[model samples]
Target: MPDSLAAALTGLAFGLSLIVAIGAQNAFVLRTGLRRTHVLPVVAVCALSDAVLILAGVGGLGTLVDRHPAVLTVARVAGAAFLLGYAVVAARRALRPGAVLTAEDGDAAPARVWPVVATCLALTWLNPHVYLDTVVLLGSVAGTHGDARWWFGGGAVLGSLIWFTGLGYGARLLRPLFARPGAWRVLDAAIALVMVAIAASLLLGL
Candidate 1:
């Protein structure tokens, strides 16, 4: 393979490895996609945000972010708070029957667009893990590619786009399972646990 192609594949693989894990962002995307609510905007926001961060990382902003410990500290605190709050909401949803995640919720009024957009933005931007993954780790990795770093970053960007799009659009396949209100409760419970665990890790600096 050509050097450019090789770099691209490496970047793509690395990016997917970083993002394919189960996390708060993925959980939210999965939930929203299942509900078929604002899927396009949510996926777009996630993809675009990752693309920008990956570019910034390749452009050497990763080094700047590293140099400023204070920034990371603040982000860590804020991210923890947000995750904890989201955890509480998810827990409540899990406990309440026919509350939000009811399988028969199709007849329910659609959520306001602004709130969904806001949540998507907050989930994408407020998490310090995003910065660490996209800006610092990926950036440092791309720097090793020398002249091919930008090509590598481009591939990473593509990976983010593909993943988010597939996740948001492909979630329909699971619609049947989520058709049961119990499944939504289980899912929400899982999300709540994941969020709380992550938040605790962040708070304890683990």
Candidate 2:
């Protein structure tokens, strides 16, 4: 394959590889999207985080993460714990009866943007798996390229933008369905189940 073609194809694959996995961050994005909540702030934080991590991965930080098995292990355990707590919260919300809905409450126009952005940043950064997957593993893989390092990182960032934007804003089309209180409960319960399953899998390595 030609160099440019090779770079783009490699980038596409790299981006897809880093995504397509279940995680709390993604679930939150989808939830917010369905609820027609804050969109730009959520998408921006997710995209920016992806760019930062991709850059770190391409710039040789992967070596440091690779050498620090203890760090990854600690992060994995901590992430699992966090997920467990979040899962319980989601389950509770799902099972609870919702308050009476009104036009004002369902408007979704009141969604705060900055706080949501901040929350996303914390969630993306705090998870240790982010480092392992984006900075370490993807970085190490990108390092194999002789002259396509930027291509690799760019591809990864593209993946992030696509996924995050899709999750955070794409669900707007389903707003009519998700606007219902019962829909929220159903979504929350589904999120909880997925989170619990992922947390257990991470803890058990199965």
Candidate 3:
């Protein structure tokens, strides 16, 4: 492969390796996608935010972030709180026997756009893990590509776009399984646990 192609492939693989994990952000995206609610905006925010972060990392902002530990410290506190709160909500939903996960529940309420977008932003921005992966780790890796760092960043950005798009849209395939209320309850319960675990990890500075 050519240098540029090699760099891009390296970036893509690296990016996917980091992002293809079960985390709060992925949980939110999966849930929202299952619900078919504001998938476009949610995916857009995630992909674009990632692109910005990756670029910032490659641009040497990672060094600046490292120099200022306080920024990440603040993010850690707030992100933990946010995750904890979200977990409580998810737990409540799971506990509610009447709460159906299917989008067609007669009592199912339509979600507004902005609130979902706000949550998406919070999930994307507030988490220090994201910064660590995209800015610090990816940035450091990109530096190794030398002049091809930008291409590497570009590939990472593309990876993010493809992942988010597929995840958000591909959720529809699970619609049949999620058609049952029990499936939704289980998913909510899992999400709640994941959120709590990540939040605790953040608080403990893990």
- The lDDT per prediction is 0.90, 0.76, 0.93
Top candidate when judged by lDDT against the true structure? 3
C-alpha root-mean-square deviation, candidate 1: 1.2
Better of 1 and 2 by lDDT: 1
Q: Which residue pairs show backbone clashes in model 2? A: none
Candidate 1 local lDDT, 106-202, one digit each (tens):
4376688889889988988888888888999999999999999999999999999999999998988889998888898899999999999989888
Instruction: Between candidates 1 and 2, name the one with more favorable TM-score.
Output: 1
Worst 10 residues of 1 by lDDT: 100-109
The digit string of per-residue lDDT tens for model 2 on 1-206 reads 77656765686687777776777788878876765667677888888988898898899888988888787777767777877888887888877756423223646455577766765675677677789788988888787876887787787788788888877777777777765677778878888998788678777852
Error of 1 at 35 (Å): 0.5
Cα lDDT tens digits for candidate 3, 132-185: 889999999999999999999999999999999999999989888888888899
TM-score, predicted candidate 1 vs. hidden true structure: 0.96
Better of 1 and 3 by lDDT: 3
Q: Which stretches in model 3 have alpha-carbon errors above 4 Å?
A: 106-108
